[model samples]
Structures are given as structure tokens and as C-alpha cells.
Target chain A: MSKVMVVTSGKGGVGKTTSCASLGAALAQAGRNVVVVDFDVGLRNLDLVMGAERRVVFDLVNVVQGDAKLPQALIRDKRIDTLSLLPASQTRDKDALTEEGVGRVIDELREKFDWIVCDSPAGIDKGATLAMRFADLAVVVANPEVSSVRDSDRIIGLLDSKTRRAESGEAMEKHLLLTRLDAARAARGEMMKVEDVLEVLAIPLLGTVAESPDVLTASNLGCPITLHSPTSPAARAYTAAARKLLGETVTVTPAREKRGFMSLLFGKKAVLQ
Target chain B: MSILNFFSRNRSAPVARERLQLLLAHERTLAGKSDLVALLQREVLGVIARHIAIDPDKVIVKLDETGHVSTLEIDIEVPEGALARG
Candidate 1:
């Protein structure tokens, strides 16, 4: 069945776009036709992240407002044959997206794609609400911090009350995707532990991406981390998350602090210093 | 562990967890209360109306939280002699 998933976080700068890009690519690489739709509207960035910024002649707003067709707006990824991107418009505001228009686009995309990943804007605003309106599942991204967790809790409340599934009394499936976890900091009690985040959120964890330079490097290069650094920790984490979303019972362990060669040679005391 | 650990205040992880627990508990209750009460009122009216004709406007359903305890208070004003007809 075709599943419409929204990658959302109530707080900004918590890696929702990155997650959407990575997860969409990972799913497409797994042989499923996937289209990652950017719903941030005016503050469009998904095209840059996916390395198709220059290719966006037609955008989501153009399609919605009847200026272009869905096929004209969709930019297929160069490397991944099955992956595509529906870029948001930089010139248009959030009000350009009507609920009916978005529904029509999603329904059309549904007929052609196995997965439609909506990249939601931060905050509990109209854009965010409309992004999740037609979703079958939600990947609630959160950082290991107080504000993010609190905002995620708020988003969870909105998800239960606002979505079509919720209105129709069908349970909306939700998964927690905790990103940018610094294992060293988390272990040293500076950052929230994975268990701590899980306890408060009370949702099944999808995956955890460790804080790494690879993520930034990939984003700067306008490539998905899975394609840019396939062996990198963040890429592996995203791939695992994608598999889990496909209903695979993969065990997800928290990212551990990597020990240096000096630490291994001189024992744990040397690393402490 | 570093000596900085002793000099530092409480571990931030636990503190963050505690704050979220409190905040979410408060938020979840407040956010869901009105909708839940309204739905409960409608469902209760549906059941009551099946057995006796009562004024739906006179039905009152409220959720009051006192500390950790929550009370779902329902008050239905049956018209005078309406009960006698049944």
C-alpha cells in the first residue's frame, strides 16, 4: 500500500528536512518509488538539500495554483531512478497552499509513488497542520533537549486531534526520530539520554542520528547522507530507520561514544583526561 | 568522570526529563480537556436520550483536575414531570 508520511518537528533546526531527505532517499534506494515533498513553502530548502535547486523550474505552488501539472513540478533525482522531489516555492507564502489543493496533489502523487514524504515546517502553524493532514504516519523529529521534547509533546497532541485519521477515529501511527544526538555529551550527563527522551515522548523510537560532520558535509554537497557517505554512522542510522518503517524488526541501539586509539591503548583513564 | 562533574549542578539529562514530564502532563490535560468533555457530553446525551426525552442543552459535562486526580462531573437537569412520564 502507498503510505503518506510526514517528517515533522514542532521546534525548528532539529533536522526535519535532513530526515525527510535521508529517509526518502533510503526508501527509494530500497526499490520503492518515493517522492519527498517540501511543504515549507516560502522558506524552501529541500531542493538544495537534494541537489536539485537548479532544476526547479516548476514548484508546488505552481502546481497547486493550476499554473503547472504535478509531473512538471516533480524533479527526479539524478542518481536514484526511483527517487523524486516536489520542491516548494520560494516566492509564494504559506497561504498559497489550500487544503483542497494539497489533497488533490497528494492523491495524484499517491497513484504514482509508493511513499510520499512531506517535509513539514517547524511550529504548530497552518503549514505544519496541512502537511500532516493527509499523512498515514508521522516521524516526529526531536533533539535531546528540553524545548524540543516539549514542542514534540505539543505536536503529538496536535497529531491526535487534528489529522484526518484522528477525526475519522482511526489511530494515526507515529514514530519518534531523535536526531543530532551527541553520544559523548549524553554519556557525560550533559545531554539527555536516549532512554530519557523515550520516557517523556512515550512513542516507539524509529532511529537516532549521532552528531557528525558527515551530515553537514553531505548537506553542503547537496546530497543525501546515505549516498554521500554510505558507511557513515548517520547514513546507517537513516537506512535502519527506513527499514524499520518498512515493518522490519531491526534492533536500534543508541549511538555509543567512539573510543579513540589512544584511549584504547592507555585505558579509560587516559580518555577521561 | 571529570572533576568538573562535582562542580557542576544537577545532571541536565534527568532535569530535562523531569521538566518535560511535568510540562507534558500539564499540557496534555489542558489541551485534551475541552474536546474530551464535549465529546463525553454528546455521547452521554445520546445514551440518556435513548431512554428518556431530556433537554440536551441542560446537560453539563466537565473535567476538573485537582492535583493528580481528575473528576468527570456530569449534571443533567431533567424537566419537572419528565421523569413521571417515563
Candidate 2:
């Protein structure tokens, strides 16, 4: 059965798009059929991040407006054959996306793919709510910061209350994807430690993506770090996160501290090294 | 500067408390001292109100943030004669 996973964080710039692209590609690379859908509307960026902007002749809005068929709007990755993208329209307003319209698209996607990864826009708005309405699981992407963790807490509360499964009193599998962790910084007590964030959020850890230029380098190339810079630390982090999401057990290493004992106490996150 | 920089917008700052302060501010403007003091006072008053009849206007709440060593100081003025019997 297909699983709908919404990558959301009420706070912005927490690498939601990057995680979506990387996780989707990683899962597809693992031979699973995955479709990453951009739900950001107006600001549609997943295509830009995925390096498929120019190839997008139609998008989610086009499909919803009945201007194009689903398959017509679906763009198969030229590089990763198993992965595909359902881009969002840069012209349509967020209001143009209806609950029923999105539901239909997700249902169709569910019938065809193993995973439908939705890249949600930031904040607790209609777009964000709808993007997560049908998610069977969620990746609450958060940066190792107090504000991000707090906002993620709000998003997590919504995931447990606003989702269909939640509405029906069913538990939705949720995971935490803590990104942009700087070991030296975290160790120095400069950044919110993973343990602190985990204690506050109280969710199972998936994997941690360090703050690294390889992420920017891959973004410039419009590819996932896993694809553009597979050997980089950030890429390995995303790959491990992807593996964990697929029900595999993987231990996440703690980032070293530059000024503190994050590394000494928790140990360097073995996978990052 | 390491101690003072905590809670700044600068990403180079070192101190989890500073990061926490900066992050809390990002989510809401009311996280500042004055705003938080007022909020804390209101909550404290409500809690005290449930237990006894007292004048809330005399309630005092102080949050001292000195180099990340924060301590909450609160004083709730009991209605003039309420404490006399106790």
C-alpha cells in the first residue's frame, strides 16, 4: 500500500524542500516507486530545488484545474528513473488548491506509487493543513533551534489532531528530521542539543543533516544531496534518514561541539563521520 | 561577548540559552522580558485566585536573566487581611 508522507515545519527555512527531494530520491534509488509532490503553490520551489523547473509544462494546479491529466503533469526524473515529481504551479494562488482537488490527486498517487511525499509550505495555513490532511506519516523537519523545535511542536500537535487518521482516532506514524546541526556549535552549547530537542519534542529520531556546503552545492545543481554529492556527510545523513523511514533501524550520532561537550557526552554521530 | 551574544540574531553566537532566546523571539514578539513578565503575572494571579481571595494588583513577578542564569521572582500581595488569619 502507498504511504502519504508530508514534510512540514511551521517554521520556515528548515530544509523541508531539500529533505523532500533527498528522501524521495533516496527511496526511489532503493527501488521503491516514489512521487514527490510540491504543495507550496504560488511559491512552488520543489521543482527549482529538484532541478526540474524548465521541464515542468504542467503542474498540480494544471491537474486540479482540469487543464492537464495527472500523467501529463507528472515529470519522470531524467537521472533517477524510479523517482518522479508532481510540481506545483508558480502562477496559482494558495487558495486555488481545494481540499477535494488535492484529495483526488493524492488518491490517484496512492494507487500508483509506494510513497507520495508532499512538500508543504510554511506556517499553519490552509495550504499547510491540506498538504497534511491525508498523510499516513509525517516528517516534521526542524532545525536544532528552540524556535524551530517549538514550532515543530505545534505542527506535531496538528498532525496528531488534523490528519484524517487522527480525526478517526488512529495514530499516524511520525518521525523527526532534525537538520542543519553543527557539531562544533552544538557541542559548545551554541545550538540546541539533539537530546534537548528530543526531550521537548519527544519523538523518535530519524537522522540529522549537518549544516554543510554540500547541501548548497547540491541545491545549485538542482539535485538532492544524495544524488549530487552522495559521498558528502549531509548526503549520508539524508540516506540514513531515508533508510530509517523505510522501517530500518539506524542510530543517529550526536554532532560534536565546538565550544561544548556535545560530542564528548553523546559521541560523534557515527554516520556523519 | 560569548555570554552577551547568546540570544542575538547572529548565527555565530555560542550558548544554547542564547539560541533559545533568539528562537523564542522569532516565534513571537511577546517573549521579551516585559511581555513575559506580564504574562507570568497573569498566570500566577489566576493560579492564586483559585486558592484564596486576594488582591491581584499587589502581585509581583520578576524574571532575572543575567548571563543565562535566569531566576523567576514572584510576589503575590495577599488581600490586606487574608494572610493575617493564617
Which has the greatest TM-score?
1
Please write out the lDDT profile of model 1 over residues B1-86, one tens digit for every residue.
34454356345777778888988886787786777888999999999999888899999997877687888889999988878888
Measured with C-alpha atoms, the lDDT of residue A4 in candidate 2 is 96
Docking quality class, candidate 1: acceptable
For residue A75, model 2's alpha carbon misses the true position, in angstroms, by 0.4
Candidate 1 chain A weakest lDDT stretch, 10 residues: A264-273
Candidate 1's residue-wise lDDT over A201-270, tens digit each? 8998999988889999999999999999988989999999999999998887556557545333432221
* Residues A1-30, model 2: lDDT tens digits: 899999999999999999999999999988
On lDDT, the candidate that comes out on top is 1
Among residues 3 or more apart in sequence or in different chains, the pairs in candidate 1 whose N, CA or C atoms overlap within 3 Å are: none
- Model 2 docking grade: incorrect
